[model samples]
Target: MTTMNKLNQVILSATLALAASGASAQMRIEISGVGSNQIPVAVAGFADENIAPQQISAIIKADLERSGAFKLIDAGVITSMSNIDYGTWKAKGADALVVGTVAKSAAGDYEVRYKLFDTVKQSELSQLNVSRAPQFTRLTAHNIADDVYLKLTGIRGAFSTRIAYVKEYDKRHYELLVADADGDGEQMALRSNEPIISPSWSPDGTKVAYVSFEQKKPVVYVQNLITRARTVIANEKGSNSSPVWAQTGNKLAVSLSKDGHTQIYTVNADGGNLKRVSNSAGIDSEANFAPDGSIYFMSDRSGGPQIYRMNGDGGEAKRVTFTGNYNISPRVSADGKTLAYISRRDGNYQLYVMDLASGQEQRLSDSTDDQYPSFAPNGKYIMYATQAGGRKSLAVVSVDGRVKQRLTTQAGNIKEPTWGPFMQ
Candidate 1:
């Protein structure tokens, strides 16, 4: 059966905490490798009469720098683009330049206009205009960063997405936190003395499904991000855990132990329409859905834990992994061409990816304790939890295992990190 060995559950009731403090608990990010040549970019402060110029530029620079794809030039050199000097920026080794202006409209809203320039070619690349309410300053900055990233990399930026994870304050206290992709502006969604695990985001990025050991038994709950209201989607005689959302966002694929052994099942977002997806006698859990409406999950029916695939209606079961004795936590890419999972090799648990068509595999992580590997929406990066300096922290790596970065908190251990879907 699937187990929650990392969770220490000794308490009973789970308290629903709504709108807990939004204090900034910054996550320190350390970049490891520059997989490719970093693009040199300069973001000039927006020309505005009210807003501080340095504030907006700092956020944009931080976002691009963290990706390990762009090298930011000094904002002090060019505060505003009222006077264009392309030759100066080009001489400073900058390939791209960004300039923008922010103003308050007659209706008391903020309007921003930005332009992107190709410094080397000495031509304009793109222009964008955005408007937002007064309270959405940070969000506006992130959207600007997203636009710049997409324009340069040709891939949709995930800067505006959120991340959900479990943080243990002590042995008896644990909380579920949701924060920005850069690990700022954290808000606590749930608090309990019991343990919480396996947080999965819905397709719309409005709800999260997770397993909470509140009643001294594991139960799955889906909580809405806006109202903070939760509904028990799975609660049976035994454990109900490892909830994964379908592409449609109306159904969930989960693992249940009510039938004596762990088996994969699908249920509506509400607690109805229960259907079994896998009928294996051994253990089967950690289900993930592909874009093609197929279910990929972990199973031990073939003597050890390995990945398996089935249709949407729970038919045509087939083994997907054969080289590893222990493989679990299968996550398929959004394109449905690659599969990332945890495998045991040389008595050490590590992360590996396999081509779904060719059945060829390549190891991605060297850590012996990496877990909960998740793919970014762009399919360019994979985020997972690993131990660093004896502390459990979250780390991300490119698909080819070239670029790497780690995000760690100063206090307690961070676990079960799941990247949210792109904002609609």
Candidate 2:
């Protein structure tokens, strides 16, 4: 199938362990090629009698700053709109200003009201009222950041989304982790002594499908995030790997070798309704669903491992890659207009993106061993795993190959990152 380190040879059994909440080591982001046209904005601390204004404003500022899209102005002197000096902010090169207030409600909850103002036009662009439980303080801040981002950029923000990945703790210990988009709020969703790989998030972001070798063979399992319970979906006669969720979240496209040759199959999320999807004699695996519901996968049907596209029911299979001899791990964007994949060029595996409309391909990563490209829900960035300094870590890059940042962990190697869908 789509070439992966065979872990079935190793045999070890271990139970899952719960790690502390949040990232063990917050990911340090490095920015590059941040465009000069960055929108300068000022975020004022929310006025509240009890809540710490800096605590809420920091999250919003960090979210905007890390995106490489906006530059934050010094708003330490401005706390609420009642004292906002729009002329001074505009003179300080701010295009927009965000001011807000947080107040405790009679029901013991918190209500946050924020306004986005266009400094140039001297008019308010948008206002938001968010009511949230006290325990969801961080989440409430992220929600405000999302709203501010959408109001200014006109595109949905993925700050509220989570990411799934595999964390290695020595040779025999591994854990599947789910973390915030900024690499914080990490939680151990699944743990095993055997190897774990290919953690895929369901479209609804409530479950994760992954391949585990705990039973001495590569088996696919879908685990519920809330209950921490799992259902063995593809533990048939042979190896099962590369489980990818369909857009509907009710089905998954996986690669199985039960019939002696690796091929793609679709199975219900609840472990029933098994149906073969690809009939190619050659190996077909790593199937990902496009926005339009078509399946794009990797196969060697043309004598080399290349990307292929086919219908959801496994008919009319067609080749999608021509320039490279080795191109695998095809991930279509949320919009289905762009395809991101890994290509082996000059003996180096790197990330590349293809514009399906113009039949154009552009290399997006410079790392030699970059793999497992997952597109952000907004389709503006792609996150993938790469080896650096002899350690595997996750990195994110803009679709255009600029604005790159790396996320590393202090625990161990990080791999197989899958960006979760937009929050419901």
Q: Least lDDT summed over 10 consecutive residues: which range in candidate 2?
A: 7-16
**Per-residue accuracy of model 2 over 137-206 as CA lDDT, tens digit each:** 5666676787778878888888867888988877788888877788876767767899999999888777
Question: How many backbone collisions does model 1 have?
Answer: 0
Error of 1 at 290 (Å): 0.5
Q: How close is candidate 1 to the true structure, as a TM-score?
A: 0.90
Q: Which one wins on lDDT?
A: 2
TM-scores, all models, native as reference: 0.90, 0.91
lDDT of 1 by residue, 84-176 (tens): 677988998888898877888887767777778888888877776766556455556666788788888888777766788988876687888
Q: What is the C-alpha local distance difference test score of candidate 2?
A: 0.82
Clashing pairs in 1: none
Off by over 4 Å in 1: 1-24, 48-54, 75-83, 103-110
